[model samples]
Target chain A: MSESNTIPKSLQEAIGTESKKLSNDIEKGAIRRFAEAIEDNNPLYVDENYAKSLGYRNVIAPPTFLRSVQTDPLPDHIKSPYSAVVDGGSVWEYFSPVCAGDIITTITTFENVFDRDGRLGNMIFLIKTTRYTNQLSELVATQTTTSITYEPKKEN
Target chain B: MNQNLYFEDIKEGMEIPTIKKNPTTQQLVKYAGASGDFYQIHYDMDYAKNNGLPGVILHGALKNAFLGQVITDWIGNSGKLKMLEVQYKGMDLPGTPVYAKGIVTDIIDENNINCDLWLETDKGDKTTVGKAIIQLPKK
Candidate 1:
């Protein structure tokens, strides 16, 4: 297996380029579906009355619910040459809750690109950081994600 | 349905309550639909097996959501979850019980508490490891 650095110069040049996307107003039905998918019956994510009792304007979303909202286009430069890509990990920071009816927006930046040796062989990793804001332009949350791209070894 | 935990009520080294989750293939399918992540690895067992996975695996984001629940449920209504960071080290399969556990690692102040959290399989293999910071109401 070859171990040369696999990240293309074009892709490397994309680091720090930011892209933005805005989402539709968060919906209660969508939040409920997400809560059900995760099998969390938390009233904060499902029952509006329960959330109101907790002082929330409406049913709020789970911390990771933003995953369902950000529908955006990925810049072509971020795509890897390898056929397989695996999620390396993620770090998330939350400042405010995302309530139903709040339209969310995100600004994503290509943060880093690097290569490393792994059990399989040489791997290239890419990191992206995204900032999420609500309709009031309040910072809601931020997530940093790392992904690894590699070619599968050929079996004899 | 648990009682709210105030900052004064919890101490360092104390274990927060655990939330047990059993992710079924059906749930993964629903999660795929709700999340708009139509990646075949989460639903197509054969495709996943061909891709080096033993079988259909749970989505990493879904596991993160479970950890979020662990913190939010423990903090109750008054307290707020400030941050959650997780690293996916191992793959988890559907039909297995994954337990989300946490131990209070540091008391930053009267209002902030830090915890070391992880998700482990019934066999005790840690599938995810991370840290979380929660803001608890001062009593």
Candidate 2:
């Protein structure tokens, strides 16, 4: 698709009306391995006894552990029909901890999209918002991520 | 914990200890389960290649979490992680060792000890350049 044809200028232009939901089973061992990957030995993520002492029901996932969860990409919207898409950047807000044995469901929706003219070239910003709820339906956290879409330079 | 590194203790040129993280496919799978992200690009190399990626790339959240861990571990439990922002510049492939390193670029004490952090990755080939701001313990 051509640059002018696909690029969006505002939140209404870039955000899709449809949203997708995803579910996952967060396990204790998985949480431990995640902690190990980052080399964080915090007992809250490992020792059950220590966690209980701290009033947690079970081992809690790292604050940013939501990264491990997969998200459904936004559906098509008006404007951009670009052939390619790549993650431009992301912003995160760490709200609460996720625990093992908790089933997490995340709903993702397009938050915003904008066009920017940079030194390298023109780029498209795609923002997605995600909400997490546990099996109990308690709100766990919310993350809004922005991905940049780069299109091929227009040809004469 | 050393609270001696007040806003005054840090300098723009000073460096924080770089953390070397060796992530395994098994760990990636675990991360995938917890994050609820089942994108085939993270697990299937063939699928990833078809989708224009070099290999199964590690989740962006995983990379960002590790960056936070690096700074939080250094600051300890007494400190509060105020804010962390990162731009996904490149890929962090599975089974690759990503070294998360940061340097203190700026320091300010606006009610809290705040320092600007810069994060980078080395996976044989370079991938992901990130910067973060963290509040550290005050003396």
Candidate 3:
């Protein structure tokens, strides 16, 4: 069966699933710090007035800022016998801008699993994708991350 | 501002001054708060281990943020950062410190100054290899 086929019939499956509704409790100061750290002075992020004038309640976080949010605690499927979690890289597809004070929920689906070879070693790749929705359940963003893990070399 | 650094000031093997940052669970939490992410692997320790991670790991974007700070600080306000790209290599766990530093690799002259940047981090069992392209101010 396909790994996506293995998403589990039950929500309680050891593999993590289920969506957590998000809140806007994130600190504006931290957002400012991140913008400064990135050297991004885009008015939407740094200037509250600018953001507000643009209809935001407060300063906006960078698109990549989504990386810092904490999700639900559960066993990840990549750890299962099928495969391991590797850092394959992530690609974020933006459908809309993320504004301050916007509560969001993310629905994550265990996408697929595969394998590959490299000069360093054998690798297992796990594909996971998440969809972010605002308070109204309106879809906001989709992020897909591919993780790769190295298995020990087999002796010939 | 500090004096402008150029290709002439650096050598291929030369290390840029090391910068240290200790990001706390609070920092990560704040990051999550701002970024609107709720991934359990970043905060729930048991969840991470159960998921096959040693513990809640640091966000890769945080590493890029650290590297961005290093370059912007070195270049000052006059220079604009044209672009930055990185491939996530590994995870960074909480409490364990992560260090980001780089070496000068190449110098490209395009009206503005640009350099090839390499970055790395060691946090307990996880070590990451990263690289970037940064534009610097011309003297």
Candidate 4:
């Protein structure tokens, strides 16, 4: 990889090895809270009876709720300036519904690290890819979060 | 949803129904608590101003959620959101009227529909731009 002045050498060096895995249990409360937070009133997310009436195993989670199951892509104790990070955006793909009572396991990997010279200034960007699998070992979803790390402004 | 949208019912360029949301600081706080993203910039005005921002800005994730609702609401419960992609191009303020708008861009397959989506402020500011692939039942 080419030398990057903006991205942390530690971050760049940690790229494939920085993967982290975690599991979260899907519950009606969290799913309902997330749906309520977004102000989404979809019965598919909150009403178990309604969900089952619609042929679902149980009340299912909204698609973007998968982000809550993610842990930091970089392993804990890795020294890096994550405080400077800004939310870039995200991309998500859903293979199946995540229902209540599902134990969702996530394996997140640092997909890439690089620098982008933009109008603001040279900045570092990191991409983290996470795959979500259920207790049934079914791949439920995959998501990638892009974060940009802007250098802290210099004080005069 | 009382009605289901079918692949055979929509055209390549037809616009899906839009969803408008007005998010307040209270809502942002709720979102922060729910999503476990407790960044002060989303709620604490002082922290936001100290960071060179005009005011507490809407979380990019919240905008994504709005866009998701726009698509999911239009596609109905039978539809599957196969893919959702978004870019945080700009910022929006809290307690403002922002609309979730989208247009069907393509019929990728007999069952898959591609659409372009965005978040627009009442002042016509486009804060986020995105795309989605929805799998609809065939008619």
lDDT of 1 by residue, B1-139 (tens): 7788788899999998999998999999999999988999999989998888899999999999999999988988888888888889899999999999999999989556889999999889999998898888777
lDDT per residue as tens, model 4, B1-139: 6488887888989998989898999899999988988889999999999988999988888888898999889888778899999998888898788999999999978557889999988888888999999988887
Lowest summed lDDT across 10 adjacent residues in model 1 chain A is found at A69-78
Better of 3 and 4 by TM-score: 4
DockQ of prediction 4: 0.80
Top candidate by lDDT: 1
Tens-digit lDDT track of model 4 for A39-141: 9999999989999998888999987898677564467633335457777899999998999999998888777887777764677777888889999999999
lDDT of 3 by residue, B49-92 (tens): 88778878776766666665566556543444444444665566
List, for all models, the DockQ compared with the true complex: 0.83, 0.40, 0.17, 0.80
Docking class of 2: acceptable
Tens digit of per-residue lDDT, candidate 2, span B1-139 = 3232345456676776777877777777766766666788888879989877898888777777777776766665444555566667667776667777677766655334434444455524446555555554556
Cα error, residue A152 of model 3, in Å, equals 13
- Return the TM-score for candidate 4, rounded to 2 decimals: 0.93
Q: What RMSD does each model have against the real structure? A: 2.2, 5.1, 8.9, 2.1
Error of 3 at A74 (Å): 24
Can you rank all candidates by TM-score, best first?
1, 4, 2, 3
Tell me the tens digit of each residue's lDDT in model 3 across A1-156: 334432233422433443444443455776677675444555656788966875667776665665654454224433534333445656555455566677766666666655556754556565667777776667766667777666444569
Chain B TM-score, candidates in order? 0.97, 0.81, 0.78, 0.96
What local lDDT score does residue A35 receive in model 4, on the 0 to 100 scale? 97
